[model samples]
Target chain A: MDRLLVVRCPDLLDEDEDGTALRSFVEVVDAVEAYCPWITAVRPGLCSLPARGPARYFGGEDALIRSIVGATSDITPVEVGVADGLFAAVLAARRGLVVPPGGTPDFLAPLPVGILGNPGLAELLARLGIRTLGDFAALPASHVLGRFGADGVTCHRVAGGRSGELAELRQPLARRRVDEQRGGGRPGGAPRRATVVDEPGFWGGVGDTDVRAGRSLAAVQDLLGPDGVVTARLQGGRGPAQRARFVTWNAREPQEDSTLGAPWPGQIPPPAPVVVHPTPLRAELVDARGEPVRVSGRCLLATAPGRLSVEEAPWAEVTAWAGPWPSDERWWSRSRRKSARMQAVAGAEAYLLLVERGRWWVEATYG
Target chain B: MFVASPDRRDVDAPPPGPSPRRSLDRERDLASLAVLAERTRPVSSSQTRLLPVVPPLADLLPDGGLRRGSTVVVTGLAGGGPEGSGGGISVALALLAAASGTGSWCALVGLPGLGAVAAHDLGIDLARSAVVPRPGAAWAEVTAVLIEGVDLVMLCPPFPPRPAMARRLVARARERRSVLVVVPGRAGWPEHPDLHLGVSDMRWDGAGTGEGYLSGRRMTVTATGRRSAARPRHRHLWLPSATGAVAEDATGTGTAG
Candidate 1:
């Protein structure tokens, strides 16, 4: 009840900081998560893990504290603090000290109110002759409410170093572990290490959007399960949106040296269609005699398409048509997909048809 | 040099003894506090801020620009308009330019054709805009996230949201004070939006023969506000002028009569 383990990684925000720093921090976080199930990320550089469970395993509080410092010493210097609650623990971590048991309130009383993290409240408190946490805690609850409704209640509670939300946070961790068990992973046991990285939304490398293609975005949300919304981050590749991917939901940087970044040896056709199927649909592009139209190796149409029929619909007369544009992509790579795209119109509907692997298919509808 | 502790209620002042003047001062302080709270109440609780659209297309809106926390349903009119056209996207993106220019973020949910290149070309800050082109059944969830963080979120949910889900999203957008542009697709449409925009008289210009390159198009955009008494206002806009940017047709066609 009177111990907290604060993990600190300095140089996290240094201009030269890179993935090395992040990786090291995640390693420290992961190592702690292996022992303690409940953790609160204080900031990018600091995190607080409850020591109640780990202290028993290591035999004592001091033993648990030493283990944490000892575990991360090789990677980089980390400062650890053990105190009554989050407020005192964070303060002690900065000073590299451990407050004695039942002394958190006394330790917090002398500290300035700036530690509460509310700058405007701190400024108002300073102007109200409350310089230290002790002075802040002395103010009448009613007076604080009259001045600053709900917000003042929190500052007053924290200034007194009282145990707050952290006591309730443990319940959720235990619940999640039980929930994890239903997934058929070591059922009914101590839930596996509960790390933030393992959290459903916390980590995403969502790349392809298959469901979005060829159907409504919500049509197949059930298909992707927890990944939920799959967005394409146009990476440093460019053939079409189908191939242009990098994997963050928001990608704006124009990928350099993309395939046919400018016009390659051949002429680049017009801009892409509005809707493109993530997966092309099988279809037939026939000439007047109903024979499948073919594109020669020289990228010329052997026979003009007289009619088009999509798998969803029967033979529709040609309203209008354009293109036979050849798309020879990544021919240098081991896996290459080459296709000829044609923009065709039929009965007020426009379609982007593809001819790949010597078979014709409807790629997307422009309408 | 200090006279009589210039302000008696100052932080450094000694605890006060009972005095009529001090009591009156406290009352005045309470009165001012009440006034300050009234003046600076949280915006969404009472009124919402407005999102400013680009100037050239401003007149097309009932308000001078797009109003925040309100949904604008945009679609192409079947009669007297280019049928099965992509003009709605142009109008929506045009509405986006002003907000994105000033660094406000815009998110596109389940709406495809969010071509980053095209958005950038139309004066949108590509880095600030997030595109969830296919959010699937998570349309409401995805839109909620964007609406919470971004100034404007454009959602083209394939099916009209169920009444319950639509109500929830509408409330969320209003609570967050962000604009939601809903272009409902085949399945259905959301509940009535605050503003309705119909694109009519859309025609491609600048391409005369087989020789000249494709330039831009002109569209008569009409806006009717559901909550306002102002009559529907229409303006002919070059959604993308020859320069590929939205410009109000000041020199071309006149405003709607």
Candidate 2:
């Protein structure tokens, strides 16, 4: 069994709200770590330090005890008890007793069963004429299990000071902290250096931390809306400035990059139109004679009209006309919505014109 | 003179008296020294550290750029502008471009539907930027955390926070030395901004229906606040000039902003 030293004060452990006991516990542990670096776990009133390596390093168990007593002497009035395991050490510390190696079970049996702090079990044990740990242990193990179930068995082991397993070790923030005073030049105690996460291309690592954080962020976004999140989806459509549109991030049916495979047409000050109406507005495309005008498949106006009014603009003469660029999506489907998108400029203002199903729509106004 | 020369000690002693010429010369030296001191007086270096704006746009800022730890209110037309959509929002993003490039994270709160393209085109690094579309009731909490962690936080406050809450946020931003750019909505600002930047008279380029492509936009940007004189400052800007970058209209009229 692994030998442990538990340092605690019984009276302070039960005091609630005021964290005076916890502070003293940490102070005692920090002081002990200076002399013996093999400190493991700490609690509000109890701390367990494995003593085999430190005992050998400091010459003997007696010398190690002297050193620990000297280190935390000025802090809290502490009881340091050494035993084979943590549960027994804590019990021994309560009584200020030290058990010789392999003598933990024998030393523990005579102690009161009430020390385990399980009220219901302690009350039942008292009723069963088992006031002491020895009486509890003397009872058949299978009988205790049958009566009190799993909790009774655990209490029985702890009362016997025969806990066979070591508690799991905790190492949170173990790398980020260093005690310069106690471990000035210790190689293992050096400050943490930059890791792969600091590198620009460190995203290649499996289960990347950034990606994990992004997943949580996306989850938050999902809680807010059905749309995954608004992302910039730049398009290679005729309108260069309006090429970027707010699209909901969909896991399925993602929009293809409009310009990814094909060579981008222009460089700076893109030639495509700047403003795109994400949701095209329905409007009337009239002719010069103030009548609803229609343009045929070849983009030829049937009896050219003189007026252009989309989104209720003052019927302005089309001072400039760009293109009837064909904008067709899902042509094969019966519900295919196809239209010819045209750019019209009237005195420093540009409008996106769409003719679909014999109806007109103003896609966007550059103004 | 001959009698004084006869006794060398007496001549030397008697000559040791104040003369008008020497006194006048001493007074002249003192006056010249006073003038020299006045000419080299100490200059005030009270100008605070600032977040960088592009060189052309810097002139439009009161302190030549966004002031650190100071909240600047940027007001733009609510919905009516020749320039398509939130003009003030665009200005706010454009101002943060330099700051983001300096490797500071910028969080945009209360702004939804601001796609990545326009921000990218305006030179903001979206990799280091965060956009919180709806910060409803947790706006103050989110703003506080963002300001504490990041160097710059842009909040579009939909309504005025409680005065005490607003003061606390301002205090935290000051303590943390982070720049807070608040785009006050119709409710107005809870606390007075150190600097106020407003945009008006925005005109779009590109003419006659489809005759010419929408090339660029020009807006008149006005800046005024407590630190500046009561007189408002003005400047004309081609927000996204022909080259697709913010530049000042050199021909446009303006005093220093």
- TM-scores of the candidates are 0.52, 0.49
Q: lDDT of each prediction vs. the true structure?
A: 0.59, 0.60
**Model 2 chain B poorest ten-residue lDDT run:** B1-10
RMSD of each: 18.2, 19.3
What is candidate 2's CA lDDT for residue A30? 76
lDDT of 2 by residue, A228-283 (tens): 34445565543333456555543223224433344444222332223344455566
Candidate 1, A289: how far from true, in Å?
8.0
Error of 2 at B160 (Å): 7.7
Candidate 2 CAPRI category: incorrect
Candidate 2, residues B105-148, lDDT tens digits: the string is 56677665453555666676565566666667757655765565
Candidate 1 contains a number of clashing pairs equal to 5
CAPRI tier for the interface of model 1 = incorrect
For model 2, what is the C-alpha lDDT against the true structure?
0.60
Q: Which stretches of candidate 2 lie over 4 Å from their true place?
A: A1-196, A199-262, A265-324, A329-335, A342-355, A358-367, B1-48, B77-86, B136-141, B157-172, B184-191, B254-257
lDDT accuracy of residue A124 in candidate 2: 92
> What's the lDDT for residue B233 in model 1?
78
What is the C-alpha RMSD, rounded to one decimal, of candidate 2?
19.3
Per-residue lDDT tens digits for candidate 1, residues A117-199, read 77898899888888998899887654664464334554676677654222212223323433333343545656544332223
